[model samples]
Target chain A: MVLLLVAPAVAAGIVLLLPSARAIMRFCAMGTITTATVAACCAWRTFAGGSLQAGEWFRMDMLSAWHLVLMAGVFSAVSLYAVGYFSKELESGAFSRGKAARYAALWFGAMDAMTVVLLTDNLGVMWVGIEATTLLTAFMILTHSSPASLEAMWKYLLMCSVGVALAFIGVILAAASAESAGLTGAQVLSWTHLLDAAGSLSSAHVKMAFIFAVVGYGTKAGLAPMHSWLPDAHSQAPAPVSAMFSAFMLNAALYCVLRSLALVEAVTGSDGWGREVLLVLGLVSVLLAAVFIVGQRDIKRLLAYSSVEHIGLIAVGIGLGGAGAAAALLHAMNHSVAKTLSFMSAGRIGQAYGTNDMRRISGALHAEPLWGTGLLLGIMMLAGMAPFGIFLSEFLILKSALEGGRYLLAGALLAGLVAVFVGVMRHAIGVSWGAHEGIVRNVGAGWLDRFLVAGAILVSLVLGIWPCSRLWHVLEMASALTGGMP
Target chain B: MMPLVDSVHVLILVTCLLLLGSSRLGACIRTVAIQGIVAGGVLPWVSSLHISMQLLFTGVFVMALKGIVFPVLLSRAMREASASREMSPFVGYGTSLMAGVLFFLASLWLGAKLPTPDGVSGLAVPTACMMVSTGLFLIIARRLAVTQVIGYIVVENGIYALGLAVAHDIPVLVELGAMLDAFVAVFVMGIAIFHINREFDHMDSGRLNVLKG
Candidate 1:
């Protein structure tokens, strides 16, 4: 477990010694692969055995292990896509070796920090890990610093910093509740220890803590009302960075919120107060994203809003709490896969067309067929079309909500999803096959690019169609760890 | 020890009011620096558990970073930006000061509602809450980016004080890690301010509205 955290930091250091921009990008891919391999081992061990721990600080159970596997998959895919995405910049002289080195280092640093968030048993350390990710990735957003990117970077840095700082109040309160329950020293901050002592904890303190936590971490997770930074940052950042942010970073923040919800539910005797908070935030996020997606001009911002929508759905699923939690975990995986492909394709398509404005850039299929199809299918999948993992997950969430007799919640969610489907499909169809002017110079796709796009589609398809028993079992174990099941 | 902690908390609250009322950026930076020092200096005395060598070391470390280093960084950023006084803040100085007092009263009310552990000083939660509210007010009500950074520091200072009040048993490693994050946050914000000033020729964050919906 220690090695999982240490390897990425070491890789970050090693990347600084690389020679050229291309070399740095390649090194990032290799580094991510190595770390993912280590993570897979840890996750497998957690699955085979019960949990894994290193000393008193770091531990991984079914919950973190599940997130660990998803994070590794997303990071690996995004790292490979970074190589392709930056290659064009390399030719255009926009990407320098220095920039590449810095990006690679921050990439690894973010990976390491998130690993700490997932592996650490101490909630304080987890909070630290999340903060470190915010600081580390601030620069990556400005990979090609323009006025707009700088603006995005500033808003991101300030909003997330202040917001996550509020989360510290939550952490402190949780600690207070545990300490009031007679835990001492490091035990006060340990999640496992707090879970054991949840029965004796002060419910009032836990309630306050959970509310503060949802708001604070919810800000970082791009839950609405606090999601102002999401679109701006996504629109301005280089594509791979946007993918990483959309794919795993938001989930990581949401993961922290989920961890807090688990504790809150346990302390309050699982009466669903915490889940109710999540449900409200989740619904707000979905409906709000639907509103924003309707007339969005910037394609990247459109995808960004879609991210808020998907994350909202996941939160709602977890909020529904039985099969809903399991469905939420599955939704997380589906969203990561589909979102990665969409960002990569939109990035390339934007590069070909010289703008991200959906109305301005058309005939995507005529311009670059490979990425255009990727974007089209990716958006189709994202809109929760059948035979895709997202559709499956959304269906399952709705089923669970119906089973639980949350008719109002289910109706609202269905309304939001249908609105988003119409809004996004309009933009997607226009971008894919609508009329255009000048011939877009083809940026030829490499074999790896083809492989990535095909592989993502295949994964989404298979997961939707099959969802093997092993996967379902693992999802159940992870959701069970969340402890809201009746 | 209780009285000492409470007095320092009052001193910290006074600095927050000074920060809100001061129109000059330089003075605001100095006031926050003083608040940092007071907040950090009171850490050892405010522990709910016995203070150890590690706790004292952590306290001095935070004090130096928050009190000494962060002020220097903010001052340098301010000089580079060359915007001296906060000209016509969204809220005037007198009103901001009034708002600060109202925040204190509200925090007191909130503190009464919250049940603290046995060893906690009565004023700690209220003081921390006041600092957090005033800091948030500064962020929303100020025009200059530099002031916003100061507001962020005050918010963090409040959180640190809260940590001291409630959970002194937090692992030293995690505490230092949090402090490191705070340091880097300020450092990163300073660099961002430099870039923003260069690009836009002003640090008025309110005018950074080009990327809106």
Candidate 2:
């Protein structure tokens, strides 16, 4: 867990010492892989029911353990993909080595900051971590000096900064609410203590606090109304960075929301108002994403909207409560893996075609088989096709909704999912099949690319077919920690 | 001292209104600076210690950074950009001023409704909330990037004011960290504005609409 928090800092230090961009890329790749290994081991230990608490500042419980594993795994793949991507850019002289080195350093820094957000139990410190990630990644999004990139970066910064400020207000209010309950000192803001003293905390204050936090973090999670900046940022950013943003950063923000949800649920009992809010936001996000994806010209922007859709689905799952929360948690993991694969494949395809515009690119299968295959399979999985983990989790979500007698909601969700499937499949088929018209240049594929594509596909497939006892145990423990049914 | 702190709140409220009412970027920057000074002035008054070496030094830093350093940085950037006036905003200045008034009143109402945390001054919470929201409103309403940055600084000042209100046993280092982070955020914003001006040939964020979906 400590390694997860500090790996990026260590990588940054080493990268700073490296003389060349190639060396920096190699170091980052190695460092992130090591971090991923450590995180996996930590997750295993935590899954075996081992717990570690670093004072009151940080804790690795079952919930955080799952997030840690996902974050490390996704970031590791992104780092390796970045190495290949940046090296190509460097060799082609697209950017200076110095800029590439700086990007690598900040990339690891962002990973480290996000790791802290996952591991830390303190709400204030978690805000700090999230804020730090924002600062770090905002620059990464603007690696290029285009006007569009700058605008996207600024929009990202301003909107997220405002959103985070509101979140801080929520934190202050939560602390204030706890103080109103006669709790004093550090106990007033501690998550554990707040849960213990939930009955004493004012429900009205808690409700207000949750509203602000959900809006604030929900902005980061790419929920609608506040999701205006996401498409621009994700599409404008480099591909590997885009992968990281979709695959894990959104999940990190969702984790913060879930944490607050736990507190809010404890205080308000099963009032379901919070769940209703989540459901509303979720459905809106899906419907909006489906509409936008249909007209999306840029492949990256299409993927970005897909992220909004997936996040919406996860939110809806969480809102359904009971078994839905478990399904959502599982969906979160599956989506991260599948989305990373999708973005990485998209990045490679975008590079090969020399454009991200779907209109300009065609016959990706004939052009680059591995990338084309990856994009096809990944999108199919994201669209919730059978035999993928997303399919299973999404099915479970529908089952839970029906079981809960939310048939109308289940119907709407199914409609949205189907709309998304049609939209994405249309684009994917258009991009992946047919005659190759564009000049296809062979950009030599790397081992890392194969590893990511194969590994993600294998994981999704295995999770779809069989549920490992270890994963089940971890999910059970996580559900308990979240105060939801497993 | 208490009266001065209360009056500072009123001054901040007025400055926030003036900011929304102003069309000129220079005037907006000036209004924000004055708001910052009022915010800095209230900090020492809210603290328990009347006089101390550390407190005195912090006040000096606040005055220098928030009052002098930030405004100057913003002014220089505006001068370099050579865009003095904000022609039109998403919302007109008069409407924004009205919105600012509503925000202040709403904040006051919110403060009155909530139970105060221990050691928090009666005046500070509402004042801080008002200042924060006003700052947010300015950022949203203002067209020019530089003015929006000034608005961000004003919001940070309000957050600092909240920190002062609830200081109690809050460590000086944490306060310093927050201050330093705010300073850096504005500093980075200044650099970003410069880059924006150079790239886009205008600091008006209204013109930055190339990446729409």
Candidate 3:
């Protein structure tokens, strides 16, 4: 377990020894793949043998295991894509060896930080991990620095920093609430001890902690109002970085919120107070994203808004409880896969057409078949199209919401989803089939691109149709940890 | 000890007001640096506290980083940006100072409502809350990116104070980790401000409005 945490930090340093930019990218990809393989093994052990603990500070349970696997999966895919993505920049002399080295180092550094977030039992340690991520990934948005990218990086760094600092207050309050539990130093902030002593916690303190945590971590998780930094950062970052941001980084922050939600629900005796808070934030995020998506011109910004909507959907799913929580977990995975495809496609399309404006870059299918289809299908899946994993998860969430007698929530959610579907599909259609007037910059794709696109599409299809029983069982186990079980 | 803690608390409150009312970037940076030092001192100065090796190490580290290192870094960034005085702020200095007083009263009300943990000073919670509000207000009302970074550090100081008052028993490792993260956060923000100044030829963050919906 320690090896899983230490390996990435080691790889971050190891990339410095590489000879060239290409070599650095390949080395980093290989490094992430190796660490991801180890993470997968640990996750398997956790699921089969129950939670695994390291020393007294770190532990991996079903919840962390689920997120661990998701992180590993997303990182592996995006790391490979980074090699492909940066190669084009390399050819154009846009990406230098130094920039590549920094990117690779920060990439591994972020992986280590996120691993700490997933594996730690200490809530304070988790808070530290989230703050570290905000700092480490801040420069990644400025890979090819511009005024806009700098603006985005600045906003991301300060907003997330201030937001996560507020979360520290929540952690302190939670620890103070646990003081009555008589745990000694350090253990007072341990999630396990807090869970064990949840019943005796002061309700008012717990309520305050939950609110601060949701708003703070929710800011990083790209929930609405606080989601202002997200679209700008996503649209400005290099495509692979943006993919990783949308795919796993946001989920990592939300993972912190889930841990807090579990503790708060336990303290509140499962009266759905925490869940209702998530429901309102989730719905607000969905509606707000819908409003933005309808008028967005930048393709990357559109996908970024879509990420907010999907994150909102996942929050709503978990908020609905029971089967909804499980469905929400599945939705997280599906959104990661589809988002990776869409962002990668949009990035390559932008590279070809020299712009990201949906109206300007048209006839994508004619210019670049692979990524055009990827973007089209990716957007369709993100819009919760039938025969996709997102659609299945969305259906299950709505079903569970109705089953739980939340007709109003169900109605509002359905309306938001439909609005997003129409809004996104219109753009997707024009971008995929509209007329092309200018000479396209033909960028060649390697086997890695083909493999990623094919793999993501296949996974989305199989997960939608089959809804594998093993994954569902694990999802249920993880959702149960979130206090969403009936 | 009680007298010392009370004086340190007063120093923190005064620095917060100074931060809100000061128009010059240098004064704002110095005010926050002093605030950080005074706030860091609270962890060790409280009379009801027990001292350990960990607490001693944390006190020295916090004081060194917040009081000295952060100020040096921010001052350098300000020099590089060649920007001074927050002219034409979103909220005028007089109004900001008035708002600061209102925020302090609100913090006092909030502090009274929330239960203060045993052994902590009665004023600590309200003081920390005021720091948080002041930091947030500066972030929202300031025009320069450098001031925003200062605002962030002020917020970190507030949280650190809150942690000391509310949960002093946090593991040393976690506490150090949080502190280190804050240090790096300031470092990174410093680099960002430098870059923003070079790219836009100004530090006016309010003008960074190219990527809107």
Question: How far out, in Å, is residue A96 in model 1?
Answer: 0.9
* Alpha-carbon runs more than 4 Å astray in model 3: A484-486, B1-4
Off by over 4 Å in 1: B1-3, B46-51
Fraction of native Cα-Cα interface contacts (under 8 Å, chains A and B) also present in model 2:
0.22
Q: Candidate 2 lDDT, tens digit per residue, A104-133? A: 889888988888888876777777677777
Task: Quote each prediction's TM-score.
Answer: 0.98, 0.95, 0.98
Model 1, span A1-486: residue lDDT tens: 888889999999999999999999999999899899889999998988989879998899999999999999999999999998899999989999999999999999999999999998998899999999999999999999899999999999999999999998999888888866889889988999999999998788788899889999999999988899999999999999999999999999999999999999998778788999889999999999999999999999999999999999999999999899999999999999999999999999988888899988888987788899899999999999989999999999999999999999999999999999999999998999977777675788999999999999999999899999998899998997775685
Model 3: per-residue Cα lDDT over B1-213, one tens digit each: 667777778788999999998999999888887888778854465634677777777888898998899999999999998988888999999999999999999999988877888767788888889999899999999999989988888888898888787776777887888899999999998999889888889989999888899
For each candidate, what is chain B's TM-score?
Answer: 0.95, 0.91, 0.96
Return the TM-scores of chain A for each candidate in numbered order.
0.99, 0.97, 0.99
C-alpha local distance difference test of each model? 0.91, 0.82, 0.90
Once superposed on the true structure, which residue ranges of model 2 sit more than 4 Å away at CA? A483-486, B1-4, B40-44, B47-62, B117-124, B163-177
Give the C-alpha miss distance for residue A213 in model 2, angstroms.
1.1
Candidate 1, A19: how far from true, in Å? Answer: 1.1
- Please give the lDDT score at residue B53 for candidate 3: 72
